[model samples]
Target chain A: MTEEGQSEIFQKMWSRKGFRAELRAASAIAIKQWKVELSYPLSVLWFIIMPFIWFIPYLIAGTALTGSSESIHLQDLTGISDWLSYIAIGTAFTGLALSLLWGSGFALRREQNVGTLETLMTTPMNRETLVWGSTLHNLQHGGLGVILQLGASVLIFGVSLNVWGILPALAIIGLSIIAMQGVIFAVVCIVLTAKQGWMIVEFLSSILMLVAPMTYPIAVLPPILQYVSVASPLTWTVEGFRGFLMYGLAYEGVITAVIALIILDVIFVIVGTLLFRATERLVRQRGALSQF
Target chain B: MTETIQEPSTKSVESDMAYLTDFKPRIMDWSAARVFATKNLKIAIRYPANFLVWGVLPILWFAPFILMATAIAGPSTSTHFTNISGFDDFVQFSVIGWFVFMYLDNSIWGIGNNFRWEQFSGTLEPLFTAPVPRISILLGAAFSDSIQGTLQAIIMLIFAMFLFGVEYAITAIFPTVLILLIMVFALYGFGFMVAGLILVFKDPSVLTQLIAESTYMLSPIQYPVQALPKSVQAIAYVIPTTIGIITVREIAINGTMSLPAFVQSIGALGFLALIFWGLGMLSFKWAEKWTKERGHMGGF
Candidate 1:
């Protein structure tokens, strides 16, 4: 509480070495959470199993449904006979989006409920580091779900892919998740004030699922809904992944989607950080952080 | 001699024990089933935002798709699609089908996962302590969601009527309403089953998503079920939504429901409703027991 101690804290905040230390600390925390999530076998099974079950039947049905039609083909949509691959990608991205939103958004509330939020905050680790660590933890948890679903799509549906293009598709997926995390963090700020984060979670999960271009293409959506889909990062990620993996990277649209994702990520991070900082200050002054 | 030795204090204590033994739960409160239903209704009205998100939002969501499909397929396409069900306008078919499915999905997923919100809000355990059965709590939540879904569906149907310029026939109104009622109960039974899973698993997101996404493919929403392969068609008949969608479409577009079709569709839905409702109740009871034993009724 003394001036000398405050000065030391300020000094620690500013140094290059201190910044690196914070990043390392955040990474460690993120990794630890990811490990804990991996320990849940049922969670892993649910993520992978359900998508395969749904998508495989659809793939088989799709072939029969479209057998007479010449316009849409396996080669035309995603270079796979199994429409399950397309559905698989949609399912995977959805899992990722849901995880990012729920995981990071709920982290603080969970910690607070467990009576650990204050203790964690009291530690010397910077708030930014904690936020980053939580976001990373979410990404890893969600990313694993997506990967498992994708793998199941391949195995069960017999859907073949270029395989090499998966890396870029993953990068795009990561960026999309990061962008979504920003929006979720802002919502978390509102949640902190209202103490209605769970309602927000319910609303977001159900609403977003309908609005986003997850199950069907944007083409299936009306003009207005199409715009709504475009506004969501998940739509672009779905389209971009479809373009890169299914279309053999021939579509120039993937570039635009990737660029959009990057911009969204940067904007979201800045906005999330600002909202978090403002909320943190309000909580500190009002002593509301521990209220829940 | 013993009777003569009895004190007033002992007599009072004996009376108190008799009072405790004779006490019975009031008949009105014994069931308390409506409490769960009422609680859900109250929550829905109290939180209009949740209603809008789960109920009204789906209408908004499918609005765009409906408009474009109508624009591309033309108003007459309804006649073509309806020949299967007998309704003349495809828009009417879509309006009824989408709204019904939307409500069903919202109620099922909403009630199933209601615990997550309660868990996060730190109210799950306190709620469990109440004498009211947990089923009532879930039913209350489901009722709220269903009301929202119903309202949204009505509004969407009205909007579609105006937007697509489809005429409503009074003759078919009774059938349509009847079908809606059947769909509602059938879906509720299924929703409760999903809710039961949530009780057991603590997270129903995965199961909910699998069912939700797959339903769109299985149901005859955008296209006729006959468009699906024979194998897939067999599977589709097993799902209540398929019959629900077809029945709604039949009344909306075809203007007549055949005896055989009605019997088959209603029978299929009745069977499914019975199965899901039984499973849901059983699972819920098991979950209640498990939670009590494990002390995780409160913990997320």
Candidate 2:
């Protein structure tokens, strides 16, 4: 494009050219991310394969503990005796959390790594557009992971799913991904300041694994930890996903999950945007945007 | 002067030849290993946050398994597990398993990724060209990982015992120590080859992740090999950690092992230690030659 056209575009973007301009910028970043990722074919395979890598050990443990697929104790705790499906589906949902945490969390750091942070910051595109773009990229990869994991579970363990449950499950997953954006944004701020962003992710991922009911129900956690679990968007997502798939959870419970997730989504997005913008400004002022 | 030179010629020439023949660079530089290990460790120590995370990450990582097992069966013991593996307490079983798994993880990721880090930092070429033996560099990494992994593993194990109410046979400490020593040697050997493979593929995460994950699944870390299908168990035995976990657990958690089983476990680990270490050295040497020939050592 000509310099005149570029300046025109920037002028329009600066004037708050509505959601379309922001969406365009975000999609451009997403496309670029995909292009870079697709260059490494093996990494794409690993991305899809990772969920199964995590799921198998839990499967073996469950089978060994109960000596079968059914567990009466589990039934008492979660009203489900099929531990296989419970763990498999829960593990699949964790892909969303991992993608947001690892992918979007390091989005800015990644730009810094590639020597593009300065150019990116100079652009008139809203800073949150970068986050949305990375999040979109991660969601696609995470979604692929979920699909492969479910397919593998069905084939290997004969896990049955309710056909009607797919839509609600997808909805819950989408909301959970959005809710996790605030956490990812907060993590991005840490990434800007901390020398090793991975340590923070390591701590967060561990906490999520414990509290999210991925391998077990929240009832098994201590009373204090249970509150943490209750507050996590992941816990609600898993519960709702499992409820529709196997537990036959009530309609009221589904509504509650949707409402809770929607509230979390709105709060997280707003807070995440503000936090990211402020951090961006601070890093720019401190001349630390490209330090890492 | 001519008369003196005639008299000294035979002895002087013989001594000069001997000196030339004797001059050679040291094959394995222990000093280089020490330097490299110290440097790597100093860098690690500077990052206190990572150390803190590593110290506590294991408990958080393994809690889900223990909790899941408890949720399925009562917290006391699994009758089926005891029947299959002669261990009833899943918490102790998995805690020990995860502890051992950490060493394996450290060796593979630590040594393998060290080379990648070197490449990324634009030092791999210079380091390779240095006078120090290449294997010493990997050995240094192995030593650093061993030291760091050991401290973290001990702390994590202690915390796990208190948090989950896990108990082990204090009497079994001696045997467990011996088994762990052998396991470490075998793991470092495995790490050597993994480092070599990472160099060849130029992709560390995918290959290492595949190996680590596959090993976790094939090994009887979380479940008994007996619980696995016969064919799967056959494949599981190929992984050193499977036998290591079974042997350590047999002695530590189950209280004792049959003499034959004990002998078999020790013998297998010793054999693996030699085989893997030898293979590791050969693979690394070959990879070095291959990478240099292709001029890919400096290409990240």
Candidate 3:
């Protein structure tokens, strides 16, 4: 290209609100994360492999507790003798939820640990874009993991599928992720400020796994836990996915869930953004961006 | 900071003799292990809340299974489970499985990731030059991990029994404790292997996570091994936790601990520990050599 033409392209790229520049920036951050991750090949292999293996506990628990492929209580609770499918769906969403919780939640902490957080923050690019890039990378990997595991589960344990229901299920999961991001933004802010928050991550991961009926019905929990479980957006996400893919809820029920999810998304995003901004301002005021 | 015999300028005659005597690595050095173990415990105690949480929060991992068991059979009795697996109290069965797994989980993860911590702190190279036997370092780390893990496992077991209204007998507890010690031996061997891997490969938290999850799945941590598919069962047997968990749960759930089975499992665990420990030592040495050659010991 001529110098004039190149300059024009560069100017357009430099302009704010330009889709091309935003895309390139996000892509760069994603690629950077991938390269850093791939630098440790053993971890890369595990990242690709562990997401599927994460379900073994639920599967083992289901089989061992019920002692068969069929469960009378599971049948009574969800009206399905196909406990394997029920468990698979729960496990799949749980992995996705995990992606949101750890994958995105700790992205900034990772950058900080690598000594790159301050550098990224000082760049001309927006910080949220970096977060979005990291989150999408995690989500993409996580979503693919759930899909691959779901396929294997269908073949190995014989989970029933309406392949067509995947679109709607994906839609519901997509909406749920938006809601999750709001909550995660708050978590990310706190993690960025806290000291070596790995314990916090583990605590959240285990707590979320237990609180949400990812593999079992929420009704099984104590009365107090039941209320707490229902309050999680993932409860609705898993329930909606189960209803859509497993039990086939009516259209009205699906619409009601979608609306509820939308409301949650708005509330979470607003509160989350506010919390993050407050933390960010405090961090800047104290000149602590480079400290952590 | 003690000098080797080769460094005559820095080595006094008495120190040289001490170094020479320890250099052969024929005699075990309990002191070295104690030092490293104390150092590790001190580092851990730096963040007491974090240390405490790791012991307590693992109980949360057990919560879902208990909740699920309650969902399946209403927390009272499991008729189908009894018919097939010879146990009615599924909560007791699951609690025992997860409880035993705690030792394996803590040992494997703690020992493996200890290398990463050393790397991150920029001290792995000095550690390599320490005159103490490498195995002692592994044992020292494993020693502290076992303390925390064993405490947590007991806490989890008690919490589980109380929550599920399950009861344990002295008969079951005695044999289960024995089995747990054997399992810890085997797990340390595996931990050494992983630590060796981390020593060379650098921080592989994802790999450790994978190993932990795979261990949980294949070991019948929340279920009976019989529930796994035939192929998975064959694979599961290769992991020492599978046998250990099954044996431990058999004691708790049946309330009739079998001596022969317990003794046999202990033997199997010892065999695994021997193989893994040997391999782990060799791997750590190899990884140390690899890192020193590459000058990447501090390259996390």
DockQ per candidate, 2 decimals: 0.15, 0.71, 0.61
Which digits, one per residue and each the tens of the lDDT, describe model 1 over residues A46-148? 6556545544433433333333212243334333344445555766676567766777777777778769888988877887677678777777766776777
Best by lDDT: 2
Give per-residue CA lDDT, model 1, range B86-155, as digits (tens). Answer: 4455566667677557766675677777777777678888877765556666666666666667776776
Alpha-carbon shift of residue A174 in model 2 (angstroms): 2.8
Residues B59-172, model 3: lDDT tens digits: 787777677676665665676666666676676676777777788888778887777788778887788778778888888889888877776677777776777677766667
State each candidate's chain A TM-score.
0.80, 0.92, 0.89
When candidate 2 is compared with the true two-chain complex, its DockQ is 0.71
Per-residue alpha-carbon lDDT of candidate 2 for residues B1-300, written as tens digits (9 for 90 to 100): 455434667889899898778856677899889988898889888976666567688788778777888888877577888888777677788888887778887887889888888888898889988767787898898888888888887888888888878888888899888888988988888999999987888766777888878887887777888877787888888677887888888787867779888888989999989999999999999998898899999886
- What TM-score do all the candidates reach, one by one? 0.72, 0.91, 0.89
Clashing pairs in 3: none
**Candidate 3 lDDT by residue in tens digits, A92-163:** 877677877887888888877778888888766766677777777777767877887788888877888776
Model 2 gets an lDDT of 0.83
Q: TM-score of predicted model 2? A: 0.91
Relative to the real complex, the DockQ score for model 3 comes to 0.61
Find the 10 residues in a row with the least total lDDT in model 3 chain B. B72-81
